[model samples]
Target chain A: MNDGTSATVTEIDMRNTSLRDLNRQLHEATSGHFVVTNPRGAHAVAAGIDSDIVVELRGSVGYYAAGMLQRGTVIVDGNAGTGVAENMMSGVARVTGSATMSAGATGCGGLLVIEGGAGARCGISMKGLDIVVGGDIGHMGAFMAQAGNLVVLGDADHHLGDSIYEADLFVRGDVASLGADCEEKEMSAEDVDLLTQLLERAQMTADPGDFRHFGSARQLYNFHPDDINSEVAEARS
Target chain B: MTGENWHQRESYTFDRNVIAEIHRAANTGIYRIRGFGAKRRLPTFDDLVFLGASMSRYPLEGYREDCGTDVIIGEGRAERPVHLDIPITIAGMSFGSLSAQAKEALGRGANAAGTSTTTGDGGMTPEERGHSKTLVYQYLPSRYGMNPDDIRKADAIEVVVGQGAKPGGGGMLLGQKITERVAEMRTLPEGIDQRSACRHPDWTGPDDLEIKILELREIVGWQVPVYVKIGAARPFYDTALAVKAGADAVVVDGMQGGTAATQDVFIEHVGIPTIAAVPEAVRAMKELGAHRDVKLIVAGGIRTGADVAKALALGADAVSLGTAALIAIGDNSPSLEDQYQALGTTAGCWEDYQDGTDPAGITTQDPELSARLDPVVAGRRLANYLQVLTLEVQTLARANGKSHVHNLEPDDLAALTVEAAAMAKVPLAGTSWIPGMG
Candidate 1:
């Protein structure tokens, strides 16, 4: 296991090493900086990492790359497939290129950074995750997002933060449309600080003032007695 | 002058129960939402009876003979497959739906029975995880309270596609049941009627499910078995697809399976019967040439030892229990008659599990109500019930000249009804005729 830059480096060539073997070796290591070469768009390239290690993948990865990551740093030099860094607990997952749908979906805790554009349903059902997207995101981004901070430097697609609860969403560029129970809220000082930290951590050039904050309107949280009455009236009409 | 001499006739078109339901709906302008499975009569295991040994076959002594009930699920695949002393397991019921004491009791009872108990949609609670010896973590659509550490602690993983109570529908935890703890775990506001998603956010259908299963296996290092569970909507194709999706085992829950809360219409009218589901699932597995290679666990309406034996005879590797286990743990107990009446229901007909005012304290979240159910006593009762079921299965197997419970086959059974004969692929009791067989 490599300790620092000067220590012995661990390199795994996916051409020779099996996925299971590679993950097994990674899981066994406590502290190391490993470089993965020739990934060839394989799924689960560096998944279930529970230690404080560094995993750098040279090529594009398939579905669920860096999935269920606990405590580690995952850097993907190329594009990622669906659910990149999905369900990660505590870690730092950075993708240099674009990612497919549901990036960081249902993640409990982690920092997910996508340098390029992301597909639809990005950060869906995100719980306590911090996401910073440098490029534009597709439709249904952060739908039903529970608790998290999503900072987008570029334009966002339609239905951003649909049915959101307690999560803070900030977008720099134009938002196509807001979804149900989502509305633009006045940005606070704390929100600005949070955005500044996330942007600085992601190393993306964007000012906190350039973005607008959006969050839950708290309308769809509970079922009121009037809701049923209105629904019944609508049905009859 | 007496009521008996009044000569009142009930209408066949609209029965009293049906009329009452309509009246209730008209008053509320909403459909009836309740718990429990279908209350209507359906073709069940009671329609088929095992043929005891006659002059053709010699019977073993019931008390002395040893009829084995052990089952090993996910053999040859997982590093640590689930090994059960009995074939019966406790089905998945969420912590948000059931009280902590009830979840603990289920785990404790399953432990005593030397079987496995599964965690449900709301994720694994510390009470259940600590109490259960063998636990199967359910990976559901909502992904509520899902933690990778809990997944690592599980003995097995169950990817829940659907439940039998409502096949195409999702789960519902009403506002009353969503307490502070429940809300915190689900990452939602308190007192919200949480409607869980019907499909996974990242994946859809079998092809994507295969990849999802791979990710799950990778998370756990392929140490434990992974089972895919499906509601009995399309048993044959669902089973085939689940097998093709690389499941170590398949759990098929039929129409009679219980739910914590669902629309009455969906519960009663959604899926096929348990007796019909088993044969079709077995057929699919047999055709895939993975009949015993991939184990099958059947659920829904499995109440007695006879039901367990019947499921095995129809080619199920094991069976799971939800409603019956709750009953054993004091749900709908006759002792709570006064309380049940106060809630506008009878002891045997208590189906207001969604309201969360359960008299027996098994379903409610109220501290005072939840305190009434003693976990130790309830667990012992469930253990006793499981023991009785196992004994009865062994007795039937021995009487049928079988050395093991799994050895009981369809040839050793006969149907009491034409519908049963056709569905079960068995001969009629007195006649040598099966409806579709030439």
Candidate 2:
């Protein structure tokens, strides 16, 4: 629901302008489909972006691109650096290329879709954000992830889902190792359906059956005196 | 043996507390984690005496005189620097260690007192943001709840390099205090011990820190002031470095500063006393030709208005409060003596914040315990305490024959102890003898 009609497009050349001035202009300009040309891997290119508008950045961007976006859609045509869509409240931050570390980190509500691979700690400590990575994710990808769905259609790296909380993981590839307190769980029909929906949202062709679910067993959620007893009992059995 | 009464008791070097600590360490096989500041005695503001106007100068009327107590920090650097009615500010205390209600109380109290409240390690909370007139968001090592939106919402950004209790060490939020909300905010599991990293992930040195500072300014449109906070171990060097890195204000927290949880060894072993730190920080700024240019805000163990006066006299622009603010909000009240005894501690000696069983509801995350502290009442109490502190400072300023509190210089002070005189770099009472004079 931008002030400018979907037919109209506003083009901005970012070569001469400073990042602060560019972001300020975006914040001040009420609403529009802003087309940014020649980003050239600039950091926080459209950071703290608010307003119900669409931003189409032409090329690769540096760290914190589209960070803290609220009620808008940011489509990065190329690769994104660290902390893409970080702490986003509500919106869509879609990167057509791969992303660096901590993508969608601490995001409460949003849809972050990466069409390619993601670097280390991809969804670390996510909160209620759905992150869809079309390719592999690096080591400790979902470490301490609290909530939300992390869907990876390709492979995942070492120590996946280490010390994760209530966040659900859907992976379709082999993992190297697992971290403490994380466990693989059986994927139900509901899990497949969710994966199917996410894949469709990311505009990718992938089989839902190829995905496996991972989550926390919640055993280490609380400290108890009877923990030793449970461990000993399992050992005996 | 023949004269039992004549025999000296246990050696002072190996006191009961020392012996107990040895035994406790032997049994636990781990360092003791606790809250509060150093329990041992050290030279402090108590060792400093004021030269009340007596002979040559005349004392202003306590009730009628116009003694200014207002201070302006970040005067020129920031597009909008906070103009405080009083020099005392509420220091950073995390939401995880403290209840949301407690954080809200700090905000309300600071707002009422016309001072800024800091958002501590865990990130900014909505309650704090909504209640506080001026909120300083901490960019800590952990980056737990860091977001550009919250950063933009903040009035200031304090890049936390170190804390007073554990200068080189990171912070800890024990599992018992990590409730659902805290866990979600930190992106850790509920009821799991969260250990913050000691160093920032992006930058390793001061040169890199300079870049990080610029990046932060870029994020906020260069409107809010950037503050750099460091423990008071190397105040002279650290203050100079922070200024070089483009900080509008520098916060130097002394060793007596309180913490939510840290090793007992670290609390007592690290950092310098507040009495010593203020002068060093001031000296650094003065040497670098940025004395008043970059505002110096000191913290740690500041309780009384006289302490505030002494700090200002020693060249601190402002003072921040942590433990004293919590006490004002009803932590460790003598009324909770029964509860303290039940928890195997005394009222004023309570320090087990890691256990999450705070009787005063100021530290715990329990719903019932947290609800016990009403934000409105606590805020009013804090405001009342701040008013007294401001009035006392004004009274001292009037007595010193100075129109403004900042006008009271080191000349107005005299030390009562050799250690205090040496540490504070001030002359002894009725004598020109300054112990550490160069």
lDDT of 2 by residue, A1-237 (tens): 234545468777789877777787777656788889999988878877777788899999987787767778999999998778877778899999999888887677789999999998888767678999999999988777778899998899999988787899999898877776788999999888888888888788988898889998777564434344456678999
Model 1, span B1-438: residue lDDT tens: 348865666777887988997777665666778999988999999999999899987788999978899998878878999999998999999898999999999999999999999998898988889999999999988899998899999999999998998998888889899999888888888888887878787877898889888988888898999999999999999999999999999999999999999989999999998888999999999999999899999999999999999999999989999999999999999999999999988999999898889988898787788899999999999999999999999998899898888888888889999999988888989888999888
**For model 2, what is the error of residue A234's alpha carbon versus the real structure, in angstroms, after optimal superposition?**
21
The TM-score obtained by model 2 is: 0.83
Highest lDDT model number: 1
The positional error of residue B268 in candidate 2, measured at the CA in angstroms, is 2.9
Task: List residue ranges in candidate 1 displaced over 4 A.
Answer: A1-7, A225-237, B1-11, B436-438
Q: Write the per-residue lDDT of candidate 2 for residues B184-206, one digit (tens) a residue.
A: 78877777767776766444578
Model 2 lDDT, residue B110, Cα? 93
